[model samples]
Target chain A: MLTAHKIKVFQSLDKKKFRQKYNLFLVEGNKTIKEIPNSHFKIREIFSLDPSEIPTGDFDTTKITPKDLKKISFLQHPKDSVAVCELGEEKFLANLPIQIVLDGIQDPGNLGTIIRLADWFGIPQIICSEDTVDLYNPKVIQASMGSFLRVNVVYRDLVEYLTHSDAAKIGTDMDGENLYHHKFPEKFNLILGNEGNGMRPETERLLTEKITIPRFGKSTESLNVSMATGIILGQIFSHKG
Target chain B: MLTAHKIKVFQSLDKKKFRQKYNLFLVEGNKTIKEIPNSHFKIREIFSLDPSEIPTGDFDTTKITPKDLKKISFLQHPKDSVAVCELGEEKFLANLPIQIVLDGIQDPGNLGTIIRLADWFGIPQIICSEDTVDLYNPKVIQASMGSFLRVNVVYRDLVEYLTHSDAAKIGTDMDGENLYHHKFPEKFNLILGNEGNGMRPETERLLTEKITIPRFGKSTESLNVSMATGIILGQIFSHKG
Candidate 1:
C-alpha cells in the first residue's frame, strides 16, 4: 500500500535537488527494473501495477494501483514497473586507454546516448564537468537503456581533472586535424562539449590536441555531439582490429 | 493579417492526415526558417512574432502576437518564427555510391538524427519503409537541426525497392561479418531496422550481406539505430581517404 507521502517522495525523484536530498533516483520500465539486481545500484523500493512485472528477487515490492502509478511515473506511456534506486558512490578511475570527458552536455538524450556508446566501446568510466546534465535524469536513464549500470560516470571540475591528467587531452574542433588521419594515443581523454556551444573557452585551453570529423557535404554545419562521439569511437576501435 | 481559420490550418499541420490534406509541413525556429530560401521546398506562408525574425528574402512575412503563435506552435517553448513549407516531390536517386534505407523506424528523433548523419557524410538520399514515421513530424524536423533541407527522404515498399535494385542490400545483425573486416561494395543500400523489433523477416530475407559492429563490452545489447549508422558511415568514409 503506497501512502500519499510515499507517492510524493517518488514524484520528487524527478528533480535533481530531490534526488540529491534523498540520494535516490527513479528507474522505470520492467526491463530496466530487472537489470538493477545485477548492477551495483541498490533498489530502495519497487512499485508495480502488476505483481508479475516485478523481477524475481528477494527485495520487497509494493503493489500499487494504476492511479497511484500515474502520479509517480515520468514516461508519457508509463511502464508496469518503477524502482527507486539508491545512488552509488562514483569513483574516478584514471589511466584508462580511452576515457570520455564531457564538458557540459546539456541534453539528457545526448548524455544517455554517450553513456551507451561508452558501454559499447567497453569504456568503463566517464568524467563530466559539474554543469553537465545529471546522470540520474529520468530521460537520460530511459535513453541509456540500462547501459548506465555498466558504465561509471563521475562529475568533477574539468579544469582540475584535465590539468592533472598525464595522458593526451583531445578536444574536437571544426578546424582541427582530420579524425581519419589523427592517431589517438594509447591513453587519452576524449572530451565532448555542449549541444549549442562547443566546449567552454577555459576548458578548451587544456587540450593537448584537437581533432575533427571532416565534412563530406556542403551544407550541414555540424553533426549531433552524440553522433560525433560514436563516429570517433568507431574509428578508434577499428584500429585495434 | 492572422485569421482564426489560418491558425486551425497551422495547428492541423502537426498531424499527418491534415498535413497531407493541405500538402504542407511546419518548419519552426528562427535558425531553421533562415535555411528555407536556399532549399528546393517552397514557403507557402511565414508567420513571426517579430517580423525581423523572419528570413530576409522576397517572401512576405505576417507579424502575429505571441498568443497567436502559441496556438499553432508544436514546440514546448515556441520560437519567434514559423513557416509552412510545401512538401516537395521526393525522387529516389539510385546508383549512388551508398544510400540509407530505414525499415519501420518509429521515433522521430532517430529519423531526424539519421537524416543529419546522412547530410554530414554527403549521402544524398534515404529510402524509408511505408510504415516508418512520417518525415514531416515536428519532432523529426526539430531534431534534424535543418539537415532535412539538404537530404531527400522518400517512403516506398521495401520488398519492391530491394528486389528491383541491383546494388548490394546490407543489413546489420549480431551474427554477421565484423564491420571492421567487411568490405562494402561501391554501390550498396544500407538498411537500418525498427527500434524495437529490428527488420521484418521478409525484409531481412532480401539482404545480400550482413555486417555487425563488434562490441567491446558485454552488457550493451545494441546501439541506437542512428548511432550505428554514424559508426558504419564513419568506417565507410575513412576507407575513401
Candidate 2:
C-alpha cells in the first residue's frame, strides 16, 4: 500500500545527503523502534507490516505488507517495522566528566559499537572527527542496539576540540604506558582512532598521555577499534570505581 | 590460472560441511595470509592476483587475475590473495589457566571477535557449544583479524565440559556480581553466551559464579557479546596483574 512517491522518499533517507537535507533518518526493526517512545527523537512517521507491533505513540503509522516493507527497507531481512525519526538536537555538556573523541573512525559498525560502549560506561557524549562515519548510518544505528538513543554523537574538528579542551587527553597506542598501571584523571577525553591507523598525526599531537593495552599473546597486531574502546572504557570505569 | 575444478573446490570450502569433508579452509586478505607463516596451520596452496603480493612461504603459490580470485572468494570485495590452509591440530591443554567457553554463539563475527579478545588477554583456548558457528567460516576468519592463528577453538558439549572441569566456572549474566570487584581465580572457565540470549539454561546450571559488567547509563539493555567478552577479559587481566 506504499505509493511510488512515498517509496522514493523512504529510499532517499538511506543516503547521508538526503538524511542531512531532510533532517530525518530511518530506524528499522521492532526492537530499535520500541526504544523510540522513551527517546528524545521525534517519530516523523512509521511503516509496519503489523500495526500492533508498532509501539504506541502519537506519530502517524501506516500498515503495510512484508513485501511492501521490503521495497523501502535498508536491511536485507527487513524487520516487521521501520520508523522515520527526526534528528535530535545536540546537547553540549560543557562540564561532562568523561568524553570520548573518535578520530576518523571509518567503519560504521565500529562507530556504533563505540557509542554503545560509551553508553555502558555512562560516558555522556562522543565527539567524532568530521571524516568519521555518519552518525545515522543504518549499520551504525543497528550495531548501536538502541544506545544511540542515550548517547549524544556530535561531529566536529577533533584537533580544534582537543586543543581547546582543559580535560586530560588520553590516546591509545601500541607503544604507550601500560593501561593497567596508568591512572586516569577525574575528567578526561578518551580518544580512539581509525580501524586501519591509530590516531591522526594532528590529533596525536594534542594528546596529554598515550596509553597501551599490552598484548598478552602473539599474532594479533592490533585489537579492533570497538573492542579496544570497550577494554579502555572498562579500565577507566574500574579505576574510577 | 585457477582451474574450473579447483575453483569449485575452493568455493565449496565456504560451507561448514565442505570444510569438514575436505579438511581445508579459506584464508583471504594480505594481512591474514602473512600470519600463516608464524601459525601452526599448514598451507595447502595460495592464489594471488599479484604473485609479488603473496608472502614468501614454503607453500605452493599460483598467479591469478583479480576476477578469477573473486570467483572463488567468499568475501564481497576479495583481497589481493586467498590462501587455502589445512585446519591446525588441536592442542589439549590439561591445566589451562583460563579457558573461554562459548554457548550457542550464532554470529561468525562475534565468535571471531571473541577469539581475538581471548588471544589479547592470553586465554589459551576456547570451547564452543556444538551448535555454535563453525570456526572455519570465512566471516569468522575476517573478523578475528589474525587471532585465529594463535588461539585454539574446539567444539564440544559446553555443559558436559563445564561439569567435568574442576576449574571455577564463571558465567556472564545481567544480574550477577559486579565484574569490577569480583576476583578471578588462577584457573577458571569464563563462559559467554549467544548474541540474543545470555546463556542456555542447561549451561547456566554449570556455572559456579555469575559476573556482570554493571550498566553505568540508562537505555542500554545489553552489550554486544564480543564487546562484553573484551570488557570482562580486560577486568580479569587487570585483576591478575
Candidate 3:
C-alpha cells in the first residue's frame, strides 16, 4: 500500500526539475516492465498488483493492491505494475555513428517515439535542446517502449553542442537536398524540429545542410517529426558498414 | 450563437455512431483549420468564440460562446475554434503508384500518423480493416494534420481487400526478408500492424513476402509499426523511379 507521500513523489517525477534532481524516472505498464530486463536502464523500485506483474526478476519488489497501484498511475485505470528506474547518466559521443539531435520536440509521446526509433536503428545517441519534453514523463516512458533503456538520450543547449562539435549537422525541411539523392555523411548529427512549428530560424542557421524526404504525391506538407527521425535513421542504418 | 440542441448534437460526435449519424467530424484549433482549405475535405459548420475564428472563407459559420465551445470541444481547454467537416465518401484506389493496408491498427494516433505519412509520400489510398479506428476521432483528426483530406482511407474486412485486390501484399514482420535487399515491386500493398503485437498471424500468412528493416546494431527486436511504415515508404519513394 502506498502513502500520500509516495504518490506525491511519483507525480513529482513527471516534472523535469524533479527528475533531474533525483536522477530517476518511472515507466508503467506490463510492456515497459518486460522490456527493462534487456535494457541498459537500472531498476530502482518496483510496485506491482500481481505477483506475475513483472517477469521473474531480482529487482526489489513490493506487492501491493490495485488501489495502491492507482496512487502512482498516470492513466485513467492504474496499470498492473509500476517500476521506478534510474535514468542512464548522460554520455558524450565517441567513435560516433550517425546521431540525432532534437531542437524543440514538445510532445512527450513524440519525444518518446524518437527515443524508441533511435534505439531500433542503433543511432548512437540523441541530444535534445533544453526545450525538449521531459524524459521522465510517464507518457514518454510508456511511448518509448523501453527504448529509453537502450538509447543514450541527453538534454543540453543545442547552440553549445553544435558550435563545438565537428559532426556534420543535417536538418530536415520540406525544400532541401533530397535525402535520397544526398550522400549519407559518414558522421552526422540529424536535427529534428518542434512538434508544431519546426526549428527556430536561429537553429536552422547552424545546420550545415538541410535535407528532405522527397514527396512523391500531393499529400501532407511534412511528415510527423518522429517519422522524420525513423526515415533518416533507417536510411543511415542501410548505408552504414 | 449556437443553440443548446445543436450543441448537444455536435457533442455527440465524440462517439462513432454519432459521427456516422451526422456524417460529420470535428476539426480543432486554427492550424488544423488552415490546413483544410485547398484540402479535399468540405466544411459543414464552423464554431468559434469569435466571428474571426477561422481564416475567413465562403463557409457557413456559427459564432458560439466559449462555454458552448467547451461543451462540445475534445481538447482539454477549448481552442478559439473547431470546425465540423463533411466526412468524405468511401474512396477506392483508382490510380495508385502504391497503397497501404493497416491490418489491425487500433490506435487513432498511429492510424493518423500513417495517413499523414502516406499523404506526404503521395500514396493515394489506405484500406483498413473494419475494426480500425474511426478516422473522425478528434485525436485522429488532430494528428493527421490535413492529410485526411488528401488521403483516401476506407474500412473493409482485412481478407476482403487483400483477396479482391491484385496488388502484391507485402507485410512487415521479424522473420521476413531484410528490406535492405528486398526488391521493390511496382504495385505493392505495404502492410503495417498493431502496436503491441506484430501483424496478425493470418495477415502474415497472406503476405507475398514478409519483410523487415535490418537492425544495424544491438537493439530491440522490432520497430514501432508507424516507424516501420516511414522506413518502407521512404524506400519506395527513394527507389529509382
Candidate 4:
C-alpha cells in the first residue's frame, strides 16, 4: 500500500532539485521498465497495476491502483508502470572512434532523441556540457525510449574536455564544408549546439573542423537540432563515402 | 481591445472540432507568425501585446494585455503573438520527383517535423492517410517552426492514392533492402508508418519497394518516425549516386 507521504515524494521526482536531492529518478512505461534488469542503474521501487506487467527482476514491485498511479505519473496517459530508479555512477569519457558532444542543449526531448540516435548508430557514449539538460529528467527518459539503458552519458566542462581530447572536434555550422563532400575523420567528435541560438562562441572556437548539411530548399532556416543529428549520424554510418 | 466573447472563441480554436467549425487555427510564436505574409493561408486576426510585434501585413492586429493573452494562448509559455489563420485552399498533389506518404501518424509533432523535413529536402508535398493527425494542431504549428508555409500536406485514402500514382511506392521496413545499397527511383513515394504499430496491412500491400536503415546497435528496436524520415531523406537527396 502506497502512503500519502510516499506519493508526495514520488511526485517531487518530476523536478530536478528533488531528483538530485533524493538521488533517484522516475522511469515510466512497460517497455522502458522491462530493460532495467540488464542495466547498471538500480531500481529502488516499481509501481504497477499487475506484477506480471513488469519484467522479472530483483527490484521491489508495489501494487498500485489506477487512481493512485495517476497522482505520480508525469504523462498525459499514465502507462502500466512507474519505477523509481537509483542514479548510476558517473562515467568518464572513453577513447572511441566516433563520439557525440552536446553543448547547452535545453530540450529534454532533443537530448533523449539524440541518445536514441546514438544507440541506433552504435555510438557507445554521449559527452555533454555541464549546462545541458539533466539526463535524469523524466521527459528525457520517456523520449529516449529505453535506449538510455545502453548508451553512457557523461557530463563535463566542454572547454576542458574538447581542449584535452586528441580526436578531431567537428561542429555543425552553416558556412562549414558541405556534409556530402566533406571527408569525416575516422576518429572525431560530432558536436551539436543549442536550439534557438547556435553553439556558444567559446565552444565554437575549439572545433578543428566544421560541416554543414546543404539545404535543398530556401524556405527552412534550419532543421530541428535532434533531426539534424539523426541525418548526420545516418550519413556517417552509411557504407557510401 | 479584446472582448470576453472574442477571447472565448479564440481559446476554443485549441480543439479540432471547434477549429474545423470556425475554419481557423492558432499559430504561435513571432517566428512562425512572420512567415504568414508569403503563404496562401489568410490571417483573420492577430493578437499581441504590441502591434509592432505583428509582421507588416494585410491582417488586422489587435493589442492585447499579457494577462488577457494568457486566456487565449495554448502554450504553457506563450510567444509574443498568436495568429488565427484561415485554412488554406486544399491543393491536390502535383507530379513531383519525390513525395512523402504518412500512414496513420497520430502525433502532431511528428507530422510537423516531417513537414519541416520535406521543406529541407525540397520535397513539395506530403500525402497522408485519412486517419492521420490533423495538420492544424497547435503543437504541430509550434514544432514545424514555420516550415508549414512551404510544404503542402494533403490527406487522402492511402490505398487509392498509392494505386493511382504511377511512381514507385517505397515503404520502410526491417526486412527491406539496406538504404545505402537500395537504388532510389527518380520518381517515387516514400511511405512511413505509425509509431507504435507499423503501417496498416493494406498500406503495406501497396508498396513497390521496401528499404531499411540498417541497425549498428542491438539495443534500439526502432527510430522515432520523424528521425527515420530525416535519415532516409538525407540519403535520398545526397550527391552520392
Candidate 5:
C-alpha cells in the first residue's frame, strides 16, 4: 500500500515550489523514463505500475497501480511510468557563444522545442520570464527529447535579466530590422516573445535592436514562436562559423 | 434534411482513395475556414455546429450537431467547425529558385509544420512521396495555418523527383557533411526523411550530397524531423540574403 507521505510528495513535485523544496522534476512516458538511467541527473524515485523495463539503479522507487499513475500523469491517457530527477540550478553563463531569452513563451511544446533548438546550436543558457511555463512541466520534458538534461533554463523576470546582460539584447518583431539586412552580434541575447503577443512594449524598450523575418505572404502574418526560434538560431549559429 | 449522397462524399474524403478520386481534402477551425476565402482553391462544403458565422456561398453546408462533429473531427475534442476543400492542382514551379522534397514524412503534423516553414521562408514548392500524409489531411490543414493557400505541394516518387531535378539534390543524413562546413548550392532541392527511420538506402544513394546538423551533445542523436526542417530552412534563407 502507498503511504500518504509518498503520494503527497509525488503530487507536490508538479509545482515549482515543490520542485524547489525537493530539488526534483518529473520525467514521464516509458521512453522518457528509460532515458533517465543514461542521464547524469540523479533520480529520486520511479512511480509506476511496472518496473521490469526500467534498469536496476540506486534510485528509490515505489510500485503503484496504473490508476495511481494516472492520477499524476499530465497526459489525458497516462503512460506506463514516470521518474523524478533532481533539478539542477542554472550555472554561470560562460561568454562562449549565443544566448537566448524566452520572453514569455507559455506553451510547453514550444518551450521544449526551443530548448531542443538551444541544444542543437550548443547554446549554453536560456533565461526565461517568471510568467513562462515551468521548465519541469512534463509536457516540456517530453517535447524536449532529453535536451532539458543538457540546456540550462533559469527563471527570472526577463526585463531584469535583459537589463543586466552586457550582451546585445535583440528582440524579434514584425516592424524591426529585416533579418536579411541586419548584422548579428557575436555575443548577444536573442529574445523571442510569446506566441499570441510578440513581445511586451516594455520588453521592446530593453532591446538593443529589433529584427524581423520578411513575410512571404500575408496569409499568416508570422511563423509559430518555436519555428521562429529555430530560424533565428540557425541564422546566428551559421554566422558564428 | 442531410442526404445520403452528401454523407457519402464527406465519409469518402476521410479515406485517401476517395480523396484522390474526388480531389477533396478537409480543413478545420474558424481561422482556417476564414483564410480559405482569400485562397485560390474552391470549397466543397462547410460542416459546422454553428451556422450563424458561416458565409453565404455556393458551397454545400450541413448543420452538424456538436456530438456529430466529434465523429468527423480528427481532434480528440472537435473544433467548432470543419470543411471539405477541393485540393487545387497548380504548378507554381514554372521556374524554381528553391524547392523542398519530403521523403516519406508520415506524420501529418510534421508535414504541415514543414509546409508552414516553407511558406515562411518563401520557398516555392514542396515535392512529397506518394506515401506522405495527404496535404489536405485536416491535421495538416490545421497545423499549416493557411500555408496551403499560397504554397504548392506535389506528390511523386521521391527517387524519380531527385534524379530529374536540374537543381542540386540535397538530403540530410547522419553520416554526411556537416551543414555548417558544407558549401551550399544556390538552387537546390532539399530532401528530408521521416521522423525516426531516415531516408531509404535507395533514396540516400541519389542524394547529390548528404548533410547533417552537428549535434553538441553525445546523447542527442537527432532533432525532430520538423525541427530539422526549420533549422535547415533557416540556414538556407540566411545564406540567400
Candidate 6:
C-alpha cells in the first residue's frame, strides 16, 4: 500500500526538476526493474502488483494493487512493478576509444534507443547537448529496456565538450563521405544531430570528419536518429574487428 | 472545411479494417504529405490549415483549421496537413536479390522504422506476417518518415511464404553464427521477429541460417527489434559493398 504522500513523490519523479532535486528516477516494467539488481544504480524503493515478482534486493518493496500501480505509472499499460532508483554517480571516462555525442536530440524514445544501441556496441559514454531529452524521462527509461543502467549519459554544452576533447570529431551529413569507405580513427566522438535537423552549426564547425550512411532509395529523407546510431556504430565496430 | 461526416470518415482510417474498407489511409504532417506528390500513391484528398502549404497537385485539397486537423490526426501534435492516400498496389518482386521479412512485428513505430531502414539500404520489398502491424497504420506511416512511399510492404502467411520461397532464409538469434562473419547470399530473405519474442518457432524452423549481431556489452537482454534490424542490415549491405 502506498501513502498519498508517497504517490505524490513517485509522480513528481516523472519531472526533471524533481528527479534532479531528489537525485532519483522511476524505472517501471518487469524487464527493466529486474535489471536493477545487477546494475550499479542504488534502489530507493520498489512498488509492485505482486511483491513476489520484485527481485530480492536490499531495497524496500511495498506490495500494491494494480489500481495503485496505475495511479503512479507513466506507462499506459502499467507493468508488474515500478522501482525508484537513485541516479548513480556520473563516472565520465577520462579517455575513451569511441564516444557518442547527441546534438539537440529531442525525442525521448530516440534518446533511449540510442542509449541501448550504445550499450549493445560497447560504447560506454554518451555526451548529449543540454537540450537533449532528460535521461530520466520515463519514456527514455522504458524504451532503453535497462540499457540506461549500463551507458553513462551526460548532458553538457556540446561545443565546449567537443573543444576540450582531443578525440577526432565525426558527424553524419547527407553529403559527407560514405560511411563504408571512411575509416574511423582508434579514438573518435561520433556526433548525431537533431531529428529534424542534422548537427547544430556550432557542433558542425568542430567536426573533423563528416560521414554519411549512404542512402540507396530516393524518398528517405533521413534515418531515425537511433536507427542511424545503430547502423553507424555497427559499421564502425564491425569494421574495427 | 471538414464536415462532421468527413471527420468521422477520416477518424475511421485510424483502424485497420476501416482503412482496408475505404482502400485509403491518413498521411499526416507537412513532410509526409509533401512526399505524396513524388510518390506512386494516388492522393484521395488533402486537408490543411493553410491550403497554400499543400503542394500544387492533381488531388483535391480543403483548407481546414488546426482544430479540424487535430480531430482527424493520429499524431498528438497535429501537423499542418493530413492527406488521404489510396493504399497503392503492392508490387511484389518475383525474384528479388535482397528482401526483408517481418515475423509478427507488432509495434507500429518498429515496423515504420524498419520500412525506412529498408528504404535506406535499397531493400525494395518487405514481406510481413499477417500478424504484423498493418502497413497502413498511421503511426507506421508517421515513423517511416515518407519511406512508406518508396518501399513495398506486403502481408502474407509466413509459413506459406517461406515454404514457397526459393531464396535463402536468414533469422537473428543470440547464439547464431556471428553476423559479421556470415556470408549473405544475393537472393535471400532477412527475417526480423516480434519485439518481445524473437522469430516464432515455426518461422525459426524455416531459417536456413540463423545470424547474431555480436553483443559487445553485458546486461543488455536484447536490442529493440528495429535497432537490431538496422545494425544487421547495415552490416550485411556494407559488407556486400
- Top candidate when judged by lDDT against the true structure: 1
Q: Distance (Å) between predicted and true CA of A174, model 3?
A: 3.7
lDDT of each: 0.89, 0.87, 0.80, 0.88, 0.78, 0.87
Of the true interface contacts, the fraction found in model 3 is: 0.64
Q: Which residue pairs collide in model 1, if any?
A: none
Off by over 4 Å in 2: B56-58
Q: Candidate 1 or 6, higher DockQ?
A: 1
CAPRI-style grade of the A/B interface in model 5: acceptable
lDDT ranking from best to worst? 1, 4, 6, 2, 3, 5
**lDDT of each residue in A27-114, candidate 1, tens digit only:** 9978878888989999888889887877766667888888788898999888898888899887778789899999999999999999
| Model 6's TM-score against the true structure | 0.95
What would the TM-scores of all predictions be? 0.97, 0.96, 0.91, 0.96, 0.85, 0.95
Instruction: Give the alpha carbon lDDT tens digit for every residue of A1-241 in model 6.
Output: 5899988988998889999998889999877888777778889889988888778888789998889999899999998988889988877775898989999999998998888888877788899999999999999998888899889998889899899999999999888998989988988999999999888898999999999887776754778788888888889878655
Per-residue accuracy of model 6 over B24-83 as CA lDDT, tens digit each: 899988877887778789898899888887787887889987777889999899988888
Tell me the tens digit of each residue's lDDT in model 2 across B86-202. 987867666798888999999999998898887777777899999999889999988888889888999888878888999999998878899998888888998999988878999
Off by over 4 Å in 5: A1-24, A29-40, A47-56, A61-81, A87-97, A217-219, B1-23, B48-55, B60-72, B76-80, B89-95, B217-219
Model 6, residue B112: what's the lDDT? Answer: 92
DockQ list for all candidates: 0.75, 0.69, 0.61, 0.63, 0.43, 0.69
lDDT of 6 at B72: 93
- Interface DockQ of candidate 3: 0.61
Alpha-carbon runs more than 4 Å astray in model 6: none
What tens digits encode model 5's per-residue C-alpha lDDT throughout A55-109?
Answer: 6689766778888887666677888887878876566565645778887889999
lDDT of 3 by residue, A34-142 (tens): 8888877788778898756577666777898887887787878778888888877677665475778899999888998888887777676888898888777878877
TM-score of chain B of 5: 0.88
The residue-by-residue lDDT of candidate 4 on B31-106, one tens digit each, is: 7788888888889889998879678677789888888779889899887888889987888867888989999999
- Candidate 3's residue-wise lDDT over B1-241, tens digit each? 4777878888888898988898988998776787787777888778877767577677877887787889989889888888888877775765364778897788888888888888888777888877788888888887787788788889887886677778788888777788878887788788888787766777777888778788765665467677788888887676752
Clashing pairs in 5: none
